[model samples]
Target: MRKRLSVSKWAITVLSILSLAFFFTLGPASKASATINYGEEVAATAETLIGSPYKYGGTSPRGFDASGLTQYVYKDAATNMKIPRTSAAQYKIGKAVKQNELKFGDLVFYATGAKGKVSFVAIYNGNGTFVGATSKGVKKVKMSDKYWKERYIGAKRVIK
Candidate 1:
């Protein structure tokens, strides 16, 4: 009886240790196997347009509006995806993504005017930073800023 009890405890201990090891190992392996993100390509292309001028309906290298910039970048990345021209329309089309889950190439939207509607859009560059066109032109700004935090409406994922 004593020998049986000792063996049972050892088995339980071994099983617990193995379970813990398996749990820890599984996470990294799954993450490593994650599919390639096209957003990374879009983001890299967007970063190159940081200094471009902001033109209301511009969609080219010469200048870009908020949604225009996003449209250009994704298209430039050769994803061949179609995107809307206005910020509000763009917001309505993509998969809803929470602010906390924003990733590279994700569309971040804002309510900028007295009417407080979704009127502006930006491409998230990760690490709390996003690039957009404002009166100030194409620039990178942080969501933590007082102005932006208050205006932030939502985010959307355009890729898959």
Candidate 2:
């Protein structure tokens, strides 16, 4: 019985080695590149609300505040990504991104009210532009704008 068991173990080991060898012959697996650009999709979704009214604590089509617009855009894009409701909380998540390296859909934060305190957020529209819900409602603003440039706190990448 011992001898029979040993033979069975030997057969199993041989089969495992053969299977590994066969897998290796196929070479290193290639990573599939994502065809869907999530950042772009998110930016597009934000654009749909360009003319939306500004509601201090709003988070829907009727109106939106700074953070509300960002959260709604991400949710609407169907990325399954959820962000914090307030700009300060949203700023706490995601990797820090440099202003020069900003990409589409990256969240750009600002200290609209006080020094070193995040109070507003916007979605980078690439090429130095961003969209957010301001006093005048949802609109695209340039990063080079004097007001925004002065209030610029930093940026974060929420999308992978």
Candidate 3:
């Protein structure tokens, strides 16, 4: 005959299993929540600039450049810190991260032009693409676009 486990032992074993599951699931859920919020903020900011013309050195609704767009989005959504207003300057302001490590609110930079002289910036939307205002206006573009993929410099996390 087999002996049954003691009540206390069974309770402890069950509790431990439940605790482990809770802890494991908690981390991923929290991360997902944060991502959702970040995505919403990014989409809202992008929507606000739907028709704003892209102007070099511009910083407001009057117009915006790549970095200006990033600054405005972060400023409006973050409300706690100010970001730099130029692509190169903004690139220097955040914690450097890899392309695959990008999260919502992270800045993605690219070198445009044959000599890689012009820099463009965008906000990662937690999807496969990023959002930014350009001469065509605010829109989402694939991170893997031929030009973007070729010019991809790196990414930076400014929110944390």
- Alpha-carbon shift of residue 56 in model 1 (angstroms): 1.7
Model 1, 1-160: lDDT tens digits are 3554345878999999998889778857556654557887677778888899988798987888888988888777756677988898998987999887888988899999755699888888989999887777888999999999999999999898
Candidate 3's TM-score reads 0.68
Clashing pairs in 3: none
Clashes per model (N, Cα, C within 3 A) = 0, 0, 0
Which candidate's TM-score is highest?
2
Q: What does candidate 2's lDDT look like per residue over 40-113, in tens digits?
A: 88998988889999999999989999999999999889586888899999999999999999989999999999
Query: What TM-score do all the candidates reach, one by one?
Result: 0.74, 0.78, 0.68
* Model 2 regions lying over 4 Å from their true place: 1-34
lDDT by residue for model 3 (50-132), tens = 67887777878778877888888777774445887678888887799877777777788888854565488988877668887
Error of 3 at 119 (Å): 1.1
Q: Evaluate all candidate structures by whole-model CA lDDT and list the values in order.
A: 0.84, 0.92, 0.76
Better of 2 and 3 by lDDT: 2
